[model samples]
Target: MRHKQVAYVLLRITIGVVFLFYGIGKFTMGRAVLVDGLVQQFAKTPLPPGLVRAFGNVIPFAEVILGFCVLFGVFTTMALALMGILLIALTFGMVLVPNPSIVANNLIYCVIVFLLLYLAEYNTFSLERLWKK
Candidate 1:
């Protein structure tokens, strides 16, 4: 029980910090530069150009918000669910590019996020607990 709790918090914090790094870099890069990078990534995919554009715009912002939520353990279930969906979308993007490392990394993140969601009740150290008082 103690070990699982430790693993859950550790994974959540680790993934959150990684996402924060990725998300913050996008903001510093600016929209045009970031979207240009995203465009290059979506180049091989058959997804509609507009849809790809939309995702490129939204993903970074979503990551920043969701990453913070997970890191602070606030509304963790909702945050974890979004993280899972993001990972799924990212997995597809990675597979399209056939980038094995990103795909594996996204999969690993999804698994940890999902497992944490399942055992979220055991998360005693979360800021979420403060709401109960």
Candidate 2:
């Protein structure tokens, strides 16, 4: 494979695996832990109690689905876009955390996701490509 193919595969797989593990970690760590983490954020925001709870519940499963989609390179563009949006939201929330490095890392991830979207046409090792051909 050429450099483009290798780059595409590497980015896709890395994004997928990172999210997949994060999603699974929610389950392994238990729901109360996740909810408590979200609770702290909720206290800082104007969001209603019910909506915050719902969001906390929805996030893990959503990450799993998004991860699967990216891993298979099916709807890669959409997956990258969604991931970008998520990173943006996470970056905003990182302000509540004490770790500055994680915020910086999230910013870097956001940039990488955007770059992949900008090069979406060159992602030749994708299920999208196979379907088109």
Candidate of highest TM-score: 1
Residue-by-residue lDDT tens digits, candidate 1, 1-133: 4887788788888878878778888888897788887788788788766777888899889889999988888888898899899999989988987899989888888888888888887787778877866
Per-residue lDDT of candidate 2, residues 1-133 (tens digit): 7888798789888888888789889978987789787877668666666766777787788778778888889888888888888777667656654458989998888877888888877788877788999
Q: What is the C-alpha lDDT of each candidate?
A: 0.84, 0.79
Which runs in model 2 stand beyond 4 Å of their true positions? Answer: 41-49, 96-99
Per-prediction TM-score to the true structure, in the order listed: 0.90, 0.85
